[model samples]
Target: MEDSIRRFFARYEQFFLRALAGEPDPAEVAGLYAEEFIAASPAGVKAGKNDASLIEAMRQGHAQYRAIGTRDMRVRGLRLSPIDEMHCVAHVAWRATYLRADLPETVIDFEVHYLMQQRQDGPRVFGWISGDETAVLRRHGVL
Candidate 1:
């Protein structure tokens, strides 16, 4: 079960990297999210009620940046508890270095918390609230 959880996270991380690199199709990314997933970040809320809405919401947010890059992504902590036979609740802490086009090579060290539901297919990231957004914005003089 631990191995499966690790694999799930690893796959999700790869999808994120691909998204940042402009590789995956929007539908591909949206498919990983649950139908009722709701993700909140410093930017805004993304209520994924359907694949098209979710993809559009994500694209709109990504459009704010000319480019996005991430490195040194690591899982700081993970706790998974069973919610049912087919689902589990996952609380995860992740750390990474984020770079955006507007930052002019400035790197933002970020730590984010994710509340997810581990389904039979994979983990659905329903909640994401970054803890380092304020500091990152301040460092970049955006705040």
Candidate 2:
């Protein structure tokens, strides 16, 4: 069960990284998220009742950047506690080196908590909240 959970998160991370690098079509990436997906960050909250809106928002977010790249993306400390047979509360830490066209390379280290539920297809993210953005910005001298 733990292995399965890890695999699910690994796939999600791969898709997320690919999207961040502008590698996949938005529609394809949206398939990874559940219908009631929400992502919370330091900037604001984004939610989608359905896949279309979620995909559109993701596309817009990708478009907002002139150029963005990532290196050494990793997920650590992935621990899952069951809410039920089909759902779990997930806690994990993420670290990545971010490269943007206008700024020097910056390392982002954050922890994320997620509500994940299993679907007929697989496990999908229902919602997630991330922390440590301010620290990342300070590291880059943005703050």
Instruction: Tell me, by TM-score, which candidate is best.
Output: 2
Give one digit per residue, the lDDT tens place, for model 2 in 1-143: 55666887787678667766667576656665677777788778977775566677767765543244454467866988889888887898777676656657777677788888887777777888886566665666644
Q: Which regions of candidate 2 are displaced past 4 Å?
A: 39-47, 64-72, 100-104, 132-135
How would you encode candidate 1's per-residue C-alpha lDDT over 1-143 as one tens digit per residue?
55666677777677665655656477666656666766677578765575676777666545433234443345667777665654565666666555555544454444555556666776666666555465675766544
The local distance difference test score of model 1 is: 0.60
Runs of candidate 1 with Cα error greater than 4 angstroms are 40-46, 65-89, 98-107, 132-135, 140-143
Which candidate should be chosen as best, given lDDT against the real structure?
2
Candidates in order, TM-scores: namely 0.64, 0.75
Least well predicted 10-residue stretch by lDDT in candidate 2: 63-72
The TM-score obtained by model 1 is 0.64
lDDT, candidates in the order shown: 0.60, 0.71
